[model samples]
Target chain A: MVNYLAGLDAVFLALADPTRRGMIERLSRGPATVGELGRPFAMTKPAITKHVRTLEQVGLVRRERIGRIHRCTLAPEAMRDAEEWIERHRRFWKSSLDRLTRHVESGDKLTLALTEERDE
Target chain B: MVNYLAGLDAVFLALADPTRRGMIERLSRGPATVGELGRPFAMTKPAITKHVRTLEQVGLVRRERIGRIHRCTLAPEAMRDAEEWIERHRRFWKSSLDRLTRHVESGDKLTLALTEERDE
Candidate 1:
């Protein structure tokens, strides 16, 4: 069995929360300071800080502090694994369904041919 | 703020578990019976069932009972929202980075012109 037990688990868990996903959405626009990242939320500074910490821990966001100002930036590479996993699964499912469709179509053709022979 | 509080939360939460991810990976190839889905794991049948139920609740899997056997299938559409979320962020991040790169390159060209004039 293929195991995605490392960073993917952390990435998905961090993304499971709406606050963090919102932070990611904001940072995806560009890097922002802690206050800026928290602007749209009614959350306390501490709560937003906690959510950013979760993203930082998951390697999804990088934080750098400069004299009381912490800037958060999206580490886009961090999402690569999770993205690839979903892409791979989608591809597999699509291809499998295509195969299933082809098989069913061929079966129908066979049935039609048998019926035609019986009619003749 | 873009709030992904609904199906996206459940989707990412369900994906956070490796076992559930594995089950998804299996079903992506095609649907399977509960026994077949559990074949690769050392876990109990109930454990596998629990994991499948979690996936089912999240709309990532569809479960159907045929006699005593339960058929588990991938609900690929359930992943579309989560996929779109990542894709949107990725597109924004990439485009923003591109803009940043362009800005920096333009600045570099200005600096080069200044240096050339100084050399002249």
Candidate 2:
């Protein structure tokens, strides 16, 4: 669980940046060289590299070097972890709300029973 | 879109902290007072308050003063935004992979046709 939370932390941090999200989107199409990844963004090569490194750190993207070229692909599995985390919490809250509704209904019934007993 | 991205940034940043995520989980059960929210954490009241404030800033939890107590409730809508963002990308990647598979299949067919023609 500690490792999972840590992985979640890294994933959220990596996703917080618009540029990084764009990179992930671009990579989703297929693997691309660093130059191809940087082409759409109006940023320096180092800036793009930093964003790529952040994605790599979170395991969101994988880099493989073929000759002098660095090819990056989207590691969708890492993204699945983040998605599952959010999905778990979303379901948690939904069930929680259901429970809260049931609790309130039971409380109302209990109150009604007490009032009837008092009157009797 | 910029506003949406900025909101996403705040939401992800707020969720990056385990403490804040815990508070969110606690709030999911139902509305709770500040004291109740702080009960699970080992941190000082002030520290817990800071985390609550961060969550409030991102609209993840709503705070309302009733009598002398402050009640915090899970604002699950904000969470939906984050979930939707991730879901969108997840779908994007899934479709992109489908397209890539089709492209590769077509390329293989084209290569086979050329080789057959050359042999003939």
Q: Which candidate tops lDDT?
A: 1
Would you estimate the TM-scores of all the predictions?
A: 0.80, 0.77
Which is the leading candidate under TM-score?
1
**Across residues A12-120, which tens digit of lDDT does each residue of candidate 2 receive?**
8888887888777777766677777776778999998999999999998888775677867677778787777777777777776675566558864533322221211
Candidate 1, DockQ to 2 decimals?
Answer: 0.31
Q: Which 10 consecutive positions of candidate 1 chain A have the poorest summed lDDT?
A: A111-120
Cα lDDT computed for each candidate against the true fold: 0.77, 0.73
Per-residue alpha-carbon lDDT of candidate 2 for residues B1-118, written as tens digits (9 for 90 to 100): 2234688888988888778877777777666777777776788999988999989989888887756767677777787888887887777777766755664578655333222212
Question: Which RMSD values do the candidates have, in order?
Answer: 9.7, 8.3
lDDT (Cα, tens digit) per residue for candidate 1, span A65-120: 75677756788788888988988898788876675456447864533322221211
Record all residue pairs in model 2 with backbone atoms less than 3 Å apart, i.e. clashing. none
TM-score of chain B of 1: 0.77
**List of clashing residue pairs for candidate 1:** none
